[model samples]
Target: MKKRFRSTNPVVVGLATGLYPFLYNYYSNFTLVDSLGQLCFFVAFFLLVPVAINICIKIASKKIPFVAKNYILLLTLSNLVGFASLLTFSILGPKKKIILLVIVLVFLLALLLKKQLKKIIFLQYLLALIVAFQLGFYIINNLNFSTQWKQLPDTILEAKFKKKPNVYIIQPDGYANANMLKKPPYAIDNSAFENFLSENNFKIYPNFRSNYSNTVTSNSSMFAMKHHYYKNPKPSSKEAFGLRKSIAGNNATLSIFNENGYKTSLLIESPYLIVNRPKLGYDYSSIAYNNLSFLSRGFDMNVNVVAEMEKAIVANKDQTNFYFVEKILPGHIPVSKSGSEGKEIERENYIDNLEKANVWLRQMITLITENDPSALVVIVADHGGYVGFNYTGELKRKVKNATLVNSIFAATLAIRWPNNEVPEFDTDLKTNVNLFRILFSYLAQEPTYRNQLEDDGSFLIVSQDVPFGVYEVIDGNGTFVFNKVSF
Candidate 1:
């Protein structure tokens, strides 16, 4: 009988190779199609690399006795290093005991299975798939961000009696309404936020809801003066209008303001702008002051905003400045220092971050008010928090925690326009999109463009992760606005 050919299984090889790309894409929040394509590419590479190495070994040494052993060892070591790196880079600080314990357990398991891991082809493939999927998911979800805003009319006829005002757009990442702050051990205390607002002569919108649950999308919409809905259907071309279009086209609010002759400057705390992607129209952008390190990170959430605002004020002391500032306060993870014991450590850390953020906000506000009392300042959250959800729960959980990731509280969308002109506080109506429209109305002396303002006079908050429900603000109540759409 002819000797049977014994070769590695294609499925095993493909899966093993694909795992790296799959995990990377998933964690990086790649679209479905892109993730799959990456997976195929990685798999092909993994299979081909081994073949190439084997051929080289045969040419160099006729026997090539330990090629398989070397390959297995290489794969195993790479996995160990990759996982270790991931743990190192996770936003969750290393101080958490639970995280440390998990790391220890993972290390022990890796060591225990070292022998089997090297020999079992199927197991190796399975391990690769699991790691790739987990890492990919992490990257993808984190990267999936969005923002929106509506246009004001070309002219505000009511301005004859009202004062023309300067506008300030303040975006606090991961801020939500105080009413829905339900995460345990670190729920937000609106009293402090309220106190800050009242002291600053600010008008707080109790019912304001963000248009989208992300900084980039909501901020883009806010600046662009456009209402954006997440539409999965591919746009006809890259030039399409909407939030998707703005991001795809690299449009920025600075461009619009610059066109209208307002000097524009960005005081952003996040690294989004630093990644060196093309941002629209910033002839004199000053982002250096906020790019300092604190607590060993690239940017210190606690002090960056205050510093950036001060710098902006100094730079635009004489100019009518349209300052776009994104404050990284009270980050989504609310961890209190007092509660850093046992399972409560994560929560405590998150709260600690928020408290630091609040401190920064207070300082920034004081500086702004002192420097430019006539500036129109609007403070709002980019999106709600993603905390305290039972991922296993049927209604709350999905492929990921995307649906349950609503912010802890509605953001404090408070506005202090120039000339002490406070628009009638419509407690019954709220929308971040409308806030942009209203601000532009005051700035441009025009009616809200397109009547783009919703008839319901309420804000609509949507997310791709959470398709079944919409968070709406009406009559000063922050509640879920149910929609029939299912994804």
Candidate 2:
């Protein structure tokens, strides 16, 4: 019973495994407690599995008695694989369950054959290398986050409109325009949706695109009305915390609304991102940013957000003017459908989701018009699809082989005003950067002056391979010019 059984220290192993993800989330300013809770679970899962495996091994390997140190090594090795895979479950997509099952079965078999496993060496140093790699990954990502653009200050730009209307801006995530949606593969029939909108006096911009192909970039640009110009290497490292916060915290959009005496409301699917949400002046409702990791933001929660909108904005009898900005992600991957088998509907989940959102939109509009009689509704999409089909074809290509998430620059834009007088915008081939400019011009009754804020058909759209991945300037073109820059 000589004891030199050098078992892996669970504390070191846990921290080494969980540190990067923790830092990755922390850099984004997600709440520490939620992330810590998940990290603790991750550590516990890794540690408990080995203990369970070790107990089973002692039972199965009494006849095949082996060195205790070898068992420790196998457990540690199993832990490394398990915890790493678990932490990255979202990115692992469908294979995570399979991987977990495989790890469990392999470890159980290895423990049963502990006599042969005793011969396994060299893993001691290999485990050290893995820990070092994890530490390095955390350090690098931390540094990447640290060096992003400085925080944007809370701005209070003043603008006064003669008549204030309750504004509801629903930014549907990944909703592509009719051109991209009606393409051959997807062929999502948007005409019914458009006609419904048209009948209600919502004009769908047929040729509109987002200023950038990325969500944060496009939305931030749209709200700020200034495209964050991409440098040679994209200076912000794709996290673009400043850009994210400018919208989430201290952007000119919310400021203008606040200064104009509107009770602002900010709501999104998830509130944890690269910003201090409290700094964003909002009188009503919005989820605060934190470090909590969310898997799919459940269907019930999203449905409840609309219900909340109805309660807070649509059905509320308050006399104060309200400006509510919410992100309604209908076109999220695999697309969420209520009361279904979680399968794609009508061979086009995005379309189905959009239509459902349309139904909700109609309800909101009818309610608001009934309550206030004067309200503006702006329905826009952040970017296009990442699914196989999008706006990329030889006919539409100025630059060949420009498939950043299937040319996700093509975006959806539509606007609804009280009376059915079509306000003259700069152009139908407008990018999302000019969204507010159009509204300002129309609302101010001075298109000739307010049109100056528009992009002038020249703005940059950024492309990133992953979430906050290496940002590159994608190739695109405007209405007047043909260029390699993708929008």
Candidate 3:
């Protein structure tokens, strides 16, 4: 038996052993403590397990006369097996039937690499450099965020408020606008929900569209009251540089509310936004998933959102409250529907969720009315359902008609003002980017703030398309115009 273990370079072995965890963290945008947890698991699995196995091999080699004196090769082979097993599980999920396939593939790969060992070594070094460069770039990008992050416009914090009504901004994820609901794929009879809002003296903006097609981008723009145009350049496709910070920490809307005498509270049904635990500005928060724990699993459904809201409302009833309740009802389908059968299934699922959303809306409205009847309630959506396409990226090619394109950007915005005190600027509220600007103006009784409101131009990023940049899908005058954004 050969005593030398030249085939397994420790750097290559380490990288192979830790690839799955690294990829997971990379995809998750390097969520702080979660990434740290993954690192810990990597160390234990890659280093500790191999060390223990090597110790056992050493012991066996000494005790048994026939045992191979060279244990380094055995240790290296064990590392390869561990890496292969983990990768196979990560890709194909936990299925016993796939084990034989994984073993066969690993055997074939080893045989091919035996003849081309030098080439394989060169490739491994190259991959290591690539991984290191990516990490370095991400670090540099984050360090520059202070200079690159979009600063909140001065107008938002300059306003003076006289009225201190309890304001509630309830966001239902992926609920299509009233017009789009009646259109194709969705053709939903959402009249019940609309009528309920109407009866409650809510002004439904039928043409209200989102400034951006995706949730993080749309809400970030809405809170900042400005179009970011996805300008915060990311190191990777899955990573977003400043959107979460804008949505949570340095939020202009939250700053305005806090600067005034209002006690702000945020209650979310899922951890999609708060999973990384960005510096939250709210005085009180009830999140569905544990932001602090990396291994935290499962999440409370939208049904529990009202209970949390009720608690928050009761706790801060004496002060002027600004509550943001985000419910993940009628959320966009997880996967893109490529075939006709898949698309039809996705449509049915979307409608089912929509129906569930209606029920939740009524429940939420009832809860609010019973507790605080004179409160200003704004029921809005983050973005449209993307009904024709399950996912937003699918719209790049699937948006063949106007209806499909509109469905991707159209979002619901309905506000029930206290004593029906609708401001003149309310009529001009066409997109969510200008949503808070109009509301703050109404609260401040300062019509001048409306003058500084951002243009109601809706923008979206469509990957795998001809012009791969932010496209202005809807103009300020509620007109559908496809123009690539210059800035």
| lDDT of each candidate versus the true structure | 0.49, 0.52, 0.70
lDDT for position 160 in model 1: 35
Better of 1 and 2 by lDDT: 2
Ranking by lDDT: 3, 2, 1
User: Across residues 199-309, which tens digit of lDDT does each residue of candidate 1 receive?
Assistant: 788877664666654555565555555554433222111111234335322344445555565676666665443322233355444444234221122232333656766
Q: Cα deviation of 71 in candidate 1 (Å)?
A: 9.3
Candidate 3 — what's its lDDT? 0.70
**TM-score of every candidate:** 0.58, 0.65, 0.81
What tens digits encode model 2's per-residue C-alpha lDDT throughout 1-487? 3322333334334444444433343333332222344456534543455445555544444455463435455544544444455445423322546767756765566556434322332342354456556545544553333322322222214456655777778776777776767774446777877787787778788656776655666776777766564322232233343555556656667767777667777655455332233355565554533332343222213324555665675444565455544555555543223323332333366666767766766666676556656678777877775445332221122333333333356677777776766665546336777677667656556545453554434333323322322233332344333333332
Model 2 ranges off by over 4 Å? 1-103, 106-156, 178-189, 230-242, 269-281, 284-301, 314-316, 319-354, 386-407, 425-429, 442-487
TM-score ranking, high to low:
3, 2, 1
Q: Candidate 3's residue-wise lDDT over 40-118, tens digit each?
A: 7646654466546655665677787554543444444444455566555444434456856776676566654444444
Q: Which portions of model 3 miss their true places by more than 4 Å?
A: 1-16, 19-24, 27-78, 81-126, 134-149, 232-239, 288-292, 295-303, 335-341, 398-400, 463-465
The TM-score, computed over Cα atoms with residue i paired to residue i, of candidate 2 is: 0.65
